[model samples]
Target: MTESDLIAALEDAGVHVVFLPYPKPGSYWHAHQLIVIDARLSSRWQRCTLAHEAVHAWYGHEGPCAPETEAWVDERAAGLLVTEQAYARAEWLHGPDVHAIADELDVTPWVIEAFQRTLRRVA
Candidate 1:
């Protein structure tokens, strides 16, 4: 989905989406204040970052926590972005070509792989 699409979704849920167009030093998303997106990134990468950040907002991750909590948040965001049905369908259709699915989803290939692995362990 487009950034506007994601923004609209979040706004509908009562979250504000703000765009900060500058050099993408690193993707950062804060839950407490608002969703600040790095506009320098491609729309695809923006979508990935948006989903990841939104996961943080959804889970109410306010501050730094235990290492396990951080890991869970990151992996959970990846899984939520890729999603269970999407993951299963991608697995069935792509047959180990995760980068292809990541290309389609606008997420990093490694994120997809990790998300798939996380789901495997979870299930």
Candidate 2:
């Protein structure tokens, strides 16, 4: 979906989103909320990152300066975008490789796998 569409989705879910300039430091900020994004990232990365971070807020995730936890956070965020249903449909409907599904969804292949894991976790 386009950035506007993504923003609209967040709004529907009752989250506020703002685009801001990236910090002087390097690296694209995926999202944070209000400060949801550092804003340096291109629009493409912006939407993907936004979806995940917004999910964090929704999930009320708490913590800081933890590597192992960051991986878990990444899964949760990715799960929000690459939802289980979407992943399954993409996998079954496409009837081919995972990369094709990722390409179709405009998300990373890891996202698709994470979505599957999320489904498994919830199920």
Best by lDDT: 1
Q: Which parts of model 1 are misplaced by more than 4 Å? A: 22-32, 92-94
What are the clash counts of all predictions, listed in order? 0, 3
- Minimal lDDT window, size 10, model 1: 24-33
Report the lDDT tens digits of candidate 2 across residue range 1-123.
Answer: 556766787677666777777562112223433425667876546766776665556555553426655567567767556655667678787875877897777776666666666667878
Candidate 2: give the clashing pairs: 31-36, 32-36, 33-36
Top of the candidates by TM-score: 1
Q: What is the TM-score of each candidate against the true structure?
A: 0.69, 0.57
Q: What is the C-alpha lDDT of each candidate?
A: 0.68, 0.62
Model 2 residue 14 distance off true place after TM-score fit, in angstroms: 8.4
- Displacement of residue 57 (Cα, Å) in model 1 is 1.5
In model 2, the runs with Cα more than 4 Å from the true position are 1-16, 21-33, 38-42, 59-65, 93-96, 120-123
